[model samples]
Target: MSHSVAEHEPAEVTESGNANGAGIDLKWLSDRVEYGLYQDCVHCGLCTASCPTYVMTGDENDSPRGRIYLMRAVVDGRASVTEKVRHHLGLCLDCRACETACPSGVQYGKLIEPFKVALEISADGDDRPPLLLRILLRHLFPYANRMKWALIPARIGMKTGLIPIARSLGLTKLLPKTLQRMEEMLPPSMPLLPPAPLPEKLEPVGKKRATVALFTGCVTDAMTPETNSATARILQHNGCEVHVVAGQACCGAVSYHSGDENGAKAFMRANLNAFDLSKYDAVIINAAGCGAMLKDYAHLMHHDPEAARAAAFTAKVKDITEFLVELGPVKPANRVEAKLTYHDACHLCHGQQIRNQPRQLLGMIEGLSIVPLEETEICCGAAGTYNLSQPEMSRRLGRRKAEYIDATGASVVAVANIGCQMQIRYYLDERGGSHEVVHPVELLDRAYGPLPGGTA
Candidate 1:
């Protein structure tokens, strides 16, 4: 994990100046993208030793130092994003393990995101998504309402034995295994509901310590509205007024990560319009992915004046665990003692740099024995759309995660992200394991009392 430092200094590039100045500036793009990494690296290669992909592949191309070298070459016009470069970039989980390991304090996450965006744009029309599949994915999967509507047919197909018949007839197997897995992973038909609308304003249950607006994210709202309900109850119990803003749609992290800048911005604007920023002391998000997006709105909305203002307003957003940890002295109820292992959601642990807060909160509950999950920070291969796009890899990662959870011998596996929950649950069910996937908030709600609807 060590490399000799080269003494030759690279020429500095200004933000507005292009290497060739032919309407495209590699230097400018790199300067803007790699803001904090310019002079920081001393070439110790410590980050390479910590990268998971590097650990698995044992290739320099898969390591952080290698990626940095590629980025530098791209900026200096010594390289174009060939298939090799793209493959290396694609392999990254963006888990940010390198950030924690870097003594020079490189901002690897920020540097990599913009690079991904640039690579995606450069590929542009040449890398057009599969026509029929693209339409379905872009239009259907990302929209919560559409996804809910589509789930109905899937449920009907499954319940009426059509899905099994199709599989029996080898029809479904004709499709990619990822699609088949997605179809299989869907829960048995349940009543789907829209997010609960915001009251004009909710008064704090006890003395009003603070007023926080809640973002009922798309996936969480459509698939598991109970998590939001639990969040509202917890917030109210902790002396905060909770407002469930209706207008906020998907946080657009999926689209953003997948290189759909237009869609991501559109969602950001919708979110701004949905939640009134001036009224609440903080914007609270239970979903780690959405929380990360809300927290980074300031940078996301930098291009537009009004949206920038809205983003500024959203700068105070906090993940529920972070907020709860800060709100000290809440009483814990002794109920439903169970052995549990906690899965660190990539977005929560790596994206938000929040590792201990969820563990700390769950530790306070009586009768809950928390066991450590092996490779807790590894991606569950549920990086928003990764499971859908890279099914084989996703399955490999998911199975690895499931085996680790099983080794802990915990009946309940607790996690904070919906993506990880679904990914892990799918693998657990596939393996015929008895373990149940549960959200930390749900456990807390159960400890407090029977949930509002008497449903688990």
Candidate 2:
């Protein structure tokens, strides 16, 4: 349970002078991370076991408690941001498993998130993300239509069987490393064929029980459109009127987690203004990461003039599973009849503390049997863009997750997040396993298909 320090705590970075012996000037740390937040860690080591990075590396620096100590030492003017320190902190998946495991209630995300952002600011030259990824993160992923346009060729290749053939023939290796990773992580696009976007307003199937706005996320609509469509249908099936609002932007997680705090706040402000927060009972989000980010708007924009509005918006944002269960899901009569296991997308289980609602929704499927997954709550290495950024560690944890799924002997694997589903499918395919990855709402939609004689 004990982790060794990287170096005998160099004097921490300070604004007045080089507290760290190297004069590295990590003073940006104090601006982003609260000094009080670091004091919350009791160093119990309970979170070490839960951290995916620590579990994989067995290094103290990778564990949450260890990482906390490192950050605290730096903040307290006792440690320098050495390569060793950066390596340990960079390895974090930011899955927030430590927060879930901590008995002392450490807000691990708050400590690490802005810290990472500040680290990027301090180390802007050498440690910046690659240009291609920077382009994708900034220009491409945040815009739904832009993402759809970008994926057009890949979709065409998948449909034409060219993509698989290229992979089998080793042709894709010529591409850049990031593009290659994208090729490898690409899920089967067959399930991407989804019904059209829900109309501006969809009335409840029978009687309107609750009126809610749907946060159809950027990649959710472009990459996995079916889940978005399914969510609306499932909401309607549960007698909820759904509104797919215009001018709604990406939930800003892609930007926020990428160290562009201002960009993320811009996206957040757009979303806050997009929906009429008071009119809806809940703002439903299908993707776990987006839901988590949406729910954190208040915290993210706490000091801004829009803080009150962000707080109100955060109160209404709900993960689809959480809202459905709370709204009392309509039991589906049709039987899915598949042996399945659920992978707890880190954001859903830990970020939102929504472990049971998803399973409860799955349990409603008449004939589907939900088998237990070892380390279900552990991230599958698709923590936002982590797979693309930290390919090696990502694959290590991805394979570990794939191995656990294979051991379960389930034909289908259900996950709530878009990234987790993609990561799980990629690894399962790499190992030649035939397990299918799907969102929990898709299964519920299939179970609630057509409502007797009506078209879905």
Candidate 3:
């Protein structure tokens, strides 16, 4: 392993990484990370109640303040980066809820993200995630077409009931542990077909209000195609000329969060060159994770030579709901009569500070009642790939979220991210609850009228 805590004794470490010149690349821990970030935490417990992991475990080390302290200690050479420390940090959802909860305005993402990247750089053969899952995460997920092709077999198995039959026969247990966890998280009855891709162009129904490029990132595109189609239709209904730009790849969130920074950068660069900012008023994204990642392009590429372009690209990025609200969305004339509650995707509400825009849009549908969900801001254990990596905690939080949604007495639940929708639906199904978890845009699309290829 590149980083072994046992080899280094306690010593005064400086902002300049690896002052003692150990075998580790301590520069990973220091470079691009401001030393002052650790100072922003006032040790206040205000964020704990809001932290999903802390609320679930009641472990101080699982809390943001505690994790910050751990990373700082390891960097300062006052403490070692033991396996326990790694576990504590790995458990983080990176939902950025702490940023919203912190009064002193701590940039927790800046600190935690770098530290996780450093761990990836330092980890050895034995320290990495499962080999099979790692390959899928690295080689498959960031590529949309590859993911769609890869899921074809699984979709067939699902349609034929072979997947459930295998589970019943205990055949799936012979598979890799990571795959087993993923299967457990699948919706009770997985869909047979992916959503149809959006056309390159969709003209406004009445008069043009805005022109936007829709971002259909990898996982969301492969897993929830209908949501993407709905988002495009909704944008069109709102008097916006929508373009599904060519050459746009995954938003790099999967790679970045998986600790492949350079790979993430490549995806980001591809997206940067894909969209002509001059042609579009704003780059719209339905998935909250992809939206946050797209909007943070400036921060991610700050050190790159093309920083200006990244910032320019980021400046025009907006969540679909945010763009609609700012554009003064036209109210849908058709009624979508249903009682549902909105479960705030952590990235949309906390990461991007987009709390009200979704509900505001949902409120516009006639005869639609938007009920309040308890602990709506809490992460639903679908923090990117957390459910696969940390199955136990993920299940606990997923079940917790399902319970809260069940208590809402609503038949449908709206979520901004595909991950949340999948997790919630799985848990709801596991509990034998008949709840339809859907993207808010899907409902809006219904309100507007029939979809492009499907009936209302």
Candidate 4:
């Protein structure tokens, strides 16, 4: 298929879905996505080798170049937003693997994210996310406090072994498809109660090299609180004063990716007002997805008056490993002698171009063995809420990842994102493998020492 799209013909569109037009103001796409981003694709097909959907489906429409063609065609009046077109676009993981693969430096996220927002607004009733999922994604997932309440039942089930009994009796099959996927992905060892909050301020263990603010994420903070606390303790151990900024909220990734653009901006704006950027040397994020979103805030609101402030904020954002490596980490004295393989979270590796800092941090652990897992950079089918939306494909990729992890014979798999952690854990459990998935900093914290004040 030809990848290049002709210039959009605005004269052809009408206000209604008449014989004259599809009622789509395709010109609006020009506002959200620059036309040059579409033209950047040369259609060399190099990206197809890296795309998770294309690799799985072996369909041209599922490939990055093909999706670009479809999106550009729709904008240029060569095509319409048909169900088939939505299927091709919706199947995408938005993991940005294609961006890393493209020689032309095609900004695929700039193209696809706007298109997702457009589809969510314009799609027919049956084509949108289900009502319950809408509530969960928009209402519950972005709110850490709300999510803790929601997980209470699951925590109880896991604590009492009722979850295992329920699965044995096929009782889990009765849940809504989304809930079933959520249930499947819940880590078995979740605590009976929600995790404790990070202290307002943690003093540096010695002379402070840097004062940093921690962006404890919404889903990540609720799901893996230890990792958040570990991140704080690790920063402190490395001679950085860590502060959990108050009134902070989600990074707007969950809402933005789920197609609530206005709501996402609201969250972003709230964060802008919350964090006093001058006091901290840098803003630290442990989760790659949140880091990428926080870093891209400047681009997301380029036209607004607050764009300059967003850009300034973005300048200070860094992933925990990236910051620690740049800050010259203290050599860990304690030994954690576990053979582990690292799974590169898509957002960290591709979205943020962070491939080696994590491995570098892991290398410092005194007695750790680092083995290369096959297909380490491949998406593990947990691109944000992807497990809920595309469970079948999610499972396929999850199982595929699990197989590679198993082949390594490593007892543990370390990942940098909450979504990847949960998805990998679920699939490894399904395949009856006993691999433990953990954040890299958790190990670093273990090697360093315990927190100064108390346990989180």
Candidates in order: C-alpha RMSD to true structure: 4.7, 2.9, 5.0, 3.7
Model 3, runs deviating above 4 Å: 1-24, 187-196, 451-456
Runs in model 4 with CA error above 4 Å? 1-25, 452-456
| Pairs of colliding residues, candidate 4 | none
Give the winner by TM-score: 4
TM-scores of the models, in the order given: 0.86, 0.94, 0.92, 0.95
Please give the TM-score that candidate 4 achieves against the real structure: 0.95
Candidate 2, 1-456: lDDT as tens digits: 543343322222222233435323355555555788889987768888899998998766678977888787666556667766777888898899999999999999998888777776566566778989988998889999887777878887888899999988999999998999988877676433434666788778887899999999998788788888889889989998889999999999888778787899999999988999778999999898999889988888777899999999999989999998888988997899999999999998899999999999999898998899999999999899998889999999999999999999999999998899899999999899988899999999999986434523
Q: Note the residue pairs that clash in candidate 2.
A: 10-78, 12-77, 12-78
Please give, for residues 78-146, the per-residue lDDT of candidate 1 as tens digits: 565665667677777776777877889887877777677666656645453445455655676667777
Predicted structure 3: clash tally: 0
**On a 0 to 100 scale, what is the lDDT of residue 409 in model 1?**
90
Which whole-number lDDT from 0 to 100 does residue 419 have in model 4? 94
lDDT of each: 0.72, 0.85, 0.84, 0.87
Candidate with top lDDT is 4
Find the number of clashing residue pairs for candidate 1: 0
Candidate closer to the true structure by lDDT (higher is better), 1 or 2: 2
Candidate 3's TM-score: 0.92
Q: What is the lDDT of candidate 2?
A: 0.85
lDDT of 4 by residue, 99-177 (tens): 9999999999999988987887777688988888888999999999899888999999999999989999999999998
